[model samples]
Target chain A: MEVKKSFEEINEKIKNGTAVVVTAEEIIDIVKEKGLDEATSHVDVVTTATFSPMCSSGAFLNFGHADPPIRMTKVLLNNVPAHAGLAAVDAYIGATETSFDRDIEYGGAHVICDLIAGKKIHLQATSPGTDCYPRKKIDTYITKDSINEAYLFNPRNCYQNYDAAINTSGRTLYTYMGVLQPNMANINYSTSGELSPLLNDPYLRTIGMGTKIFLAGAPGYVAWQGTQFITEVERGNNGVPTTSAATLAVIGDLKQMSCDYIQPAVFEKYGTSMFVGIGIPIPVLDKDMLMNLAVENKDIYTNIVDYSVGRRSKPSLGKVNYAQLRSGMVTLEGKQIPTTPLSSLSKARAIAQELKRWILTDKFTLQEPFKHFNKVSKLNTLEEVGKGEIDNE
Target chain B: MSKKAYKQRIYIEAEKCVECGACTAVCGAKALRLDKTTWKLIYNVQKCQGCMLCVSACPSRAIKSDIEDLPSAVAAAL
Candidate 1:
């Protein structure tokens, strides 16, 4: 396919309300009817979206100093613990962080959600009285507006693809994948299939640092390669990984986020996590980029993993396409297992539609990446080295 | 009466439930309640009429009808 318009030309069309924009769902059918050449010629942008429970998510808040300005070393928000390792007024509250009072239900995710929901949260802190900052004890009520700076700087948010979990043990297992029934009675899979962020960017060609994104109702950017990024994972012909591959570290202003997009979730046995609604618009730069956006449920696949094993590399029962997984049943070892998704597809589609509306109405604009991510960056695994082994290396 | 004469009731899987209170809102018999102290959903088996409303209402698929000697497929999985 020949490239007709440059990125600048597309941006000009976008600004002038002349560019044709379609969602990932819409483009699939468009590409099917009209070949890649025609699709790329007509469509200038594709909006991809996903709403998943990302555990490695948190918010950095700079709660403005109190009357006496205490150097807070320990902080609690609505009885949920917040990491006070930052400066005196700044604290980072992790999504999976649990409270000492109610460990399972109420957590840092809940606190963040409550703040987004416009609820007042109790803030408590304790610190040793120092010379510069004397006040040690602090007790106050704070809301999202009251905080000076509240932004979500998640180390990892969107995963390329993930594993479907099943329990092989005789007893039921409570895990982050939800309740995995014993003997593989039920399987829990979490992914928006074609709408997943990294899946749309497959080879990481367009999505990189400084890429504009719809982050929980507000605009955000791709900060860096997310933690535990395994870019060398095996891929299919479509360049989409069949297993867990790349991830995106995202940063957004939490104050601009709404309660609808950024929700706090509590997994039964897995503790607390947050459901982040993210939408990324991919510019149809070339035929390759267009083809990556054309990936469908049939083309994407993931492993049905046996979560009974306690290691990171759990044994895979077999690989199943998202088409089979979305059908609500997949045969594993000749046994039909019922599948459930922790992520909501309806919400994902809504986010995509919302982003599409934003782009069309000139409320949001696409951005060219300042620098692309390193595709050859290797993810290292932890290993126990022998005494003096580090010196030898 | 024989010991087997008692009818089977609804079972709430505590581990599977996220305590969203969806089941409690849909229960016509008032058989389910969320415990405030522990934040766990409590199932009153006696009040449960085996309506199975809570089973269908549960978002996480945590509630199930516990019928003994039933068909394996129905009893085994949701």
Candidate 2:
């Protein structure tokens, strides 16, 4: 691989307002029309994005010490429980934490989004008072302006690839993938295909730790590799993973976020989750990078797993590419199944365009990763000692 | 059915609908369907039986009946 244009050169072009930025979807047409040589020389960066429900998302908030500061042992914001083991007035609210008062409709994700929308939230905490800070209980209302620090620290988001789900059983299945009709009447798949971040940078060449990204409406950074991240997966011919692959642990300032990008949602029989907007700019440092960005939905494939199975490794019916999945229908076992996307492509495209604007306006700049992620990780299954035989040898 | 006669219609808020097809899946009637070409939700009010399954099945709460909304008030006024 040859470096056609360096990051410094791209940054200089961006600063001079001369950089030619295109989205991952837009780059395909450019490459197809002008060839790789022309596309490589003309484009500076390709923006990729995804807006979907990410379950492993939450924020670590530090509420400024109150008068007669009490160490918060149990923290509840808007009746949703938050992890308070960190420190006094500091807690972590997970997105999927359901509200104790409002049942499954409202959750920690709602609380976070409401706070972003400048809504007042009831804050209550109980503690064992100490001599230094002697306050047992307190009740008060707080807004985003009153908080000291609110930063989203998501553990697993921007999944490199994912599987479409269908129900093979006789009963309807309500899952994180959304509701699936029994006997494979409907298919629910996620991930903004062709426009997803990791899919655009399959080899992790440009994206890594410390890379700046569009987190909801605010700028964020990739903190580390996310949970259940497995790099070694069966990939397609285009070097993109065919099944679930890499993930990202991203962090950003929640104060600068907006409700338009970060939304709260509830799955019907399941639980609460969050819909977050994420965008990443992949620098076209070389022709290979341009070629990767040139990859289209037809080139990316994912397995359709049976959600009716209540197990980690569900049975995969068959492989279907995104082009077919996006077509709203796919045939399996000689039956036509109506398919719908869980991730919003229109919103994803908007985020990509917004990130592109930020770069063009000099409001944001791309950063080279300080370190790349390891490509050898396996998701091991936890087995009960008595229920299943242990396989850790 | 006369033109002036009030008929119930299902309305889906575009902003709230993610088009996950859950409503179509739960709809026992053939009223709610996803366009095979565009993957968009298409609701047929005539085929609906006032079951309100989609309205309840919608996780985003984006669906509603026109007869139960402002349309009902208009019908009463007329």
Q: lDDT of all the models against the reference?
A: 0.80, 0.86
Model 2 misplacement above 4 A:
A1-3, A386-393, B1-9, B18-49, B65-78
TM-score of 2: 0.92
lDDT of 2 by residue, A39-147 (tens): 8988999999998999899999988899989999999999999999988889999999999888778998888888888899999999989997799998999988998
What tens-digit string does per-residue lDDT give for candidate 1 at A253-369? 888888668777766656788888899998898888988998999999999899999996899999999888777578888898767666667677788999888889964777788
After superposing the true interface residues, what Cα RMSD does each candidate give? 11.2, 2.9
Model 2 chain A: lowest-lDDT 10 consecutive positions: A383-392
Kindly report which residue stretches of model 1 are placed more than 4 angstroms away from their true locations once superposed: A385-387, B1-78
Clashing pairs for predicted structure model 1, backbone only: none
How many residue pairs clash in all the candidates, one count each? Answer: 0, 0
Q: State what share of the real interface contacts each candidate retains.
A: 0.00, 0.33
Cα misplacement distance, residue A353 of candidate 2 (Å): 1.2
Please provide the root mean square deviation of candidate 2 (C-alpha atoms, Å): 3.8
